[model samples]
Target: MPVILPTSIINILSNLFCILINISLFYLYTFKIFYSFQENEISISLQIIGIIVNFQEILLRFFVGYYDKGEIIQDKQLILLNTLNFNFFYDLFYLATLILSQIIMYNQKNSSNLVVYFLNLIYFLKAISVNKILNKVDQLLYITAKADYIYQLLKLIFKLIIICHIVAVAWHLLAQIETNYFEKNNTWLHDLNLVDSQWYSRYIESFYWSTTTIIILAGPKGSNNIEIIFQSVIMFATMGTFAYTMNCIGVILDEQNRKQKEYKRDLEIINIYMRKNNLKKSLQQKVSNFLEYLYQEKGDIQVNKNSIEVLNKLPQNLKDDINVEINSKIIQKFKLISTNFSQKIIQEVIPFIQEECFLPNEIIYKHYQYDNLAIYWISKGKVQIEHQQENAKIVLVKVLEKGDCFSEYQFFTGKQHEYQTRSADFTTIYKIQRDKFIQTIQKYADDYEYFNMIKDQLIFRNGSIYTNIQCLICKSRYHRENECEQIHINKNKQLTILKHLRNQIQISRKPFFRKCFYFIKTIQLIKSCELCVNQIKNNQELFNLIKYIDINNNSMDLDQSLSDNYIQDKVIKNRDNSNSSLSSTSIENNVNDICKQTLKNFKNSIIINSEQINSNDNFKHSQGNKNQLEIKKELQNINLLTCIIFINIQIKRQTDQQLKKQAQIQIRIQKKQIFKNQSIQKKKKKFLQKKNLKQENPQKKYNYLFKIKQTKKNTQVIITQQKKKLVI
Candidate 1:
């Protein structure tokens, strides 16, 4: 059976332990040398340990409702509350200190107060430490452990009383245990069980001796008696009970931690497994299914360990840190493992004959360089090995475009070169350094255990050169991020990533797609689905293309028309570029024509939806402004509304709460005033009657019934007035 105990019992035990430490300190100091810190290795070690003790003190205060300065002062309560990261190490250090002081004093020479303080400190440390260990062990089982912190606190005072009793017992026991070493051992009282029969003994020493006999109960060892057997039985029972309790606590804590680990693993596995699977499920169906599951199936399954011990291999932590080992195990055991990085790396390094380009009349390799010791892979265009002799023909080696590895037979045989390597025109090929090539074929290179498999493959060095991959502008503009900060280009947007380029500048003026894409990609994340690159043909096509894109998915809600002010600015800026300047009337007519053409196309497209158009009432929209202006307005409003709503909600809640509290306070004050007024009226009526009677006859008033002015309760007011008058 479990040793079930209330918080009150635990509190009693805790405070008893605290008193034990403090009392031991005081007793040792009085009997032995007055204690001082060594100021050497022991002291430094203690100080280092003391820092942790201070932190533990802070932690205890926090748990005991001492958070603020005022709370700390007000807190008479002590609590054994388990919290984040207990100071076990600090408690151990304090225990070590208490034990050391006691041991040293027993060996050496003592003052009464110092010994008492020492004992008290020792008892305090023990009680607190015991409380913590039990508290933490209980909470690990998810039990409610706080109880009533204040009540437990008051119980601590009784623990000090218990400590005082225990310490006197320990002090006498120590003196008896070391009787041979003591100089004053021949005292008459030492031989007598002075307090055994006499509770009325005059000496305090008798009380100490009797208490020690009860706690330790040491008598002649071999002399058996029923009383001695009963004492031993009690001691044995306590030992058995504590051991059993600790054992049970340990088992529950282990199971709880294991379940937590398994649950975390299951959550991660579900996320990883579902991500790809969730994508294929239709969005509308997935959302519906998810909602249904949340309401119906959420509690059906419990969290399990994601990874199984089907194969008794590496632990999860090791597998995670060293992925190669896990991947190897997965591939060998399962036949295939889908790892994105492995797939990407294999694509990069797979041996193949690949592509190359050649300019006219450039040499691929010269005659002198073509020794039989090495091979050349003519992976691409027009390879010719030329003779070193004067006016020699540059013979075209088999023009290996692709899927071609050359000179393998000659390379391994160490034969003299039949031909030299040069370009028929200009050519490129992957050349394998023979020695290095041989070294690479020695195992997985990384898989040191499998060196034999690579030995034969090393002889034929297959090599190729492929065109390095590049980004192309197809729909979305491709741009390098580095170019966005060019001094001549716009710097209006310090944050280059999210700012819409077209909104800031004209289509022609904005950075090219190649530059912008890379720029934005660096600053902000571009989801793969969102990126579609399109190259510009010229100004007109670029403008028309830029115009139609509801590219900023957030921009489906704009008036895709040019404004009058924008048109006027455009006319003024472009007046010099065109053959002739237009009058204001001409410009307005041209703008009108432009608006008609732009609006006609814009109205036909369903890209600009109605919902985003009417989102803001304060911002005016027009038919002539381009779609970019509308995107600008919507984004601006989004920011402003977000800020306004945030501030408004915070202020409104605080004001409402404040007003509620004030109304309650006012109501309370009014009620109090009303009661006081009623009492005062009754008193005033009584006083008037007494005055009227006194006037009718000679005054006859009872002394106890006479009024005393409330203000006259404190005479300090008269003193303050007198001081002020004297100063004046």
Candidate 2:
């Protein structure tokens, strides 16, 4: 009969078995208690944390791995650490799997990964926060792509099956413990009375009492005791079942996936053909599609992915894509995508081309003009291109300083056209004729290497970048597609500026050469100023502004608005704010006495509006001349109003001296007409201001206009006056 072991003896044996198993797994730890063990090693720290996290990751991935993503090929090196210092296959598999499991659960590391690895592996002397760790954790999310699911699932199942089987074996191993290795003992082998007389004493293996019947399965088949025979059959069947299951699983995982592999091979073949054929669209689309497929298939729990992790670090391709689109549009607009040409160079370049002489207000080009070249480089100065609108003038573009080019396309394409061109300031341009440009490009492609890049970037080669800036300010980006400014610069404007400088030269009584030089410099400066550029939207207004400059006067310190193109003049105290003053005392009395003597020699400047302003409602709004003298009126009447109103507005608007001069011209014409009247001639001609003119009393020391007389012409007037009152 079989003997049953005591409960006390069974527990003592089980406890001893548990200790032996623990000692085998963590033998080094037996040297010290868990608390006393050194926790300094980074790898060890990571391993300990990994022990807990590995199981968690396996569970998390199991639910989603198979159908969620595709297979990923990874480097085997990162997993090599688990294969270290191991003999048994099961132990090596378990350790390797623990590391693999964690890596698969997490996403691939990034630049932040170095921080995470160090933190996880080593306990830092300094403190760190959980949030810091969480941040590192977040970076891993990107690498856990959908494609790595197959590997993740297979890996999880393999680990789980092996671990469960090991546990069962461990329990079974514990159940058959015997105190003595050499002496005879009744082990679990006799529980069902299957052990023969020599079963325990014989040198046999397989974790059961060795018997010839058990090893050969011949004597063991005797069924005299049916219960013992049944027990033997059951144990044998159980052992065979577990072994077969493990083998089957290992084989299934090792099999090749022919379908996925075939698809990849076919895709590569198509991509290679597209590249060889130079099919741009097809090639680009294929590349993009292939990239999408790779990411979709290869990145689940996909932690610490080798090469794939670096892909996210690549420079973004979106901007390059946008540039491609822009370049495409630019190319589409061209009449010829690629052309070869030749040119004959001429030695005698136009003086205007060499000297590049331009005043600030000089018109550089006109609209509807054609040239064949596509490149224009700015050599010096600034330029503005403007457009005409229904209600007002709009700035189309602006270019400043050197190296700006405009309208090189006209010379190259063999198109004859007319367009208005203006200089934002006196500017120099290196003009290249299209024929010459084509010949040069054909001869020296290296110098114009940027041509292709520009084409690729889609920047237009024709328009000046400065003109574009002005246009941007005046109109929204949408309005650029409409008609650009190409109106003719009126001759009247050139003459107006010329006359002002001519008058100044006359007043100085300087030599012809000196006067001409002075005029050029003054005109150039004013032309470059913001006050002129911003207000000179159209040709007519520029003409009037030129007319308004007082040639006889010398004060020309530019206000900021004029220099900077600002609309508002913050300097120059407004009359509204200038009213406050101090009570006059002895010093003021002395000043008044001096002023009384010279006051008689002064004459007020008659300011005028620009002719363009007079024609437009915007100018009317500006003038506060609400009562429309809008119709052509006596220049004298308008002159007085413009002068007074000019003082109240921004200094950059310019004094309307020119428009007031126009009014004076009309007044003189009227006077001439009156003189021509048959009976009116008989009477002494009467001046309009004669009645209001202050009489020079013999006792009065002061003569405000001692020698000044207002001489009238056709709506124009001139007063001989001292320079002091007119200037400051």
Which lDDT value does model 2 have at 467? 27
lDDT tens digits, residue span 1-728, model 1: 12223233443444344434334443333233212212245533543444344444434433332223212222233333322235545555665665565455446533234663565365454543334534443443233344333433333433333443444444344444344355444332344543133223412553453334433555222122432454365346434544554455556567646655655565566556667576554664565444444333222223112223422266555544444443333322211112211343332222321223444455544444544244455433555534344666443323444434455434443434544555554344544444443444333444322222222232232211111111111111222221333323655465665565436544676665554443436433333212222122233533453343323212212211323333344344654323222332343354345445644544444246444455655555563245555545444433443354345335534643554465456557767999999999999998998787667644344432343343465566888999999999
**Each prediction's whole-model lDDT (CA):** 0.41, 0.39
**Which residues of candidate 1, in runs, are more than 4 Å off?**
1-52, 59-129, 133-233, 239-243, 246-728
lDDT of 2 at 451: 40
Q: What's the lDDT of the predicted structure labeled candidate 1? A: 0.41
TM-score of 2: 0.18
Candidate 2, residues 666-685: lDDT per residue as tens digits? 55776778768955645443
